[model samples]
Target: MADQITGGCKCGKVRYAGTPLDAAPFRCHCRDCQQLTGSGHTEMMPLAREGFAISETCRIYEMQGGSGQSTYSGFCPDCGAQLIRRSARMGDRVYVHAGSLDDPAQYAPERSIYSDAAQPWDAGSIIKAD
Candidate 1:
């Protein structure tokens, strides 16, 4: 784990790793994220898609965004926890949820993307996404 990132599903299935959370992390307030997480925002860390390594089998689901971007969200089929997500807009970055990690400090979000859709009840200070 010192050389790379490591985390897994709640049920201990669907593990993954990548470059250390050296890559800047951010929070996403996009509607897609709020809807996907059923929360105010998504604490995601963007990393190289190729750098991501999977251990257990995961469920890959595809969805087309209103922006005409295609995305494949990968998660644990058993626990139904999202581990990583990929899209056309982000060629190499795999926006991962910070909560998924054992120690989420490395993925601390520096900003939030798409604040226009953010819930009024959410009072986070991170920069909202455009």
Candidate 2:
């Protein structure tokens, strides 16, 4: 992982910086992730919530997650760029959308979640879960 992870919204209205958590990055193929990203999956990098900080307030959308807990999606109000994902099940960490990273190339997803929900077109891209 990078020394310090940094990213922002598409409009640069909501920037974020944090220390990367020790968790493995993952690709999620859940329906909610598909809809939120408008793609087959969402690549996420976990960050320790203790030091995570966002430059501006983000518009958050809350919904029930697969774990039967509240999950929040944070986005840029101006550009509607999805930047963060947080779930009550994992309060100590926040997931940052890999696409939102300033250096997206640094993102390396090690596993896939909800792979059973993966669409046919994207099924081949699923990385085996560790």
TM-score of each: 0.86, 0.95
Which of the numbered candidates is closest to the native, going by highest TM-score? Answer: 2
Task: Return the top candidate by lDDT.
Answer: 2
For candidate 2, write residues 2-38 as lDDT tens digits.
Answer: 8789999988889999999999999999999999989
Query: What residue runs in model 1 are displaced by over 4 Å at the alpha carbon?
Result: 20-23, 128-130
Q: On a 0 to 100 scale, what is the lDDT of residue 49 in model 2?
A: 93
lDDT score of residue 86 within candidate 1 = 81
Q: Could you give candidate 1's per-residue lDDT for residues 20-123 as a string of tens digits?
A: 54566877777777777788877887766776788648888889965799987888989888887788876777777788886777666667667777788885
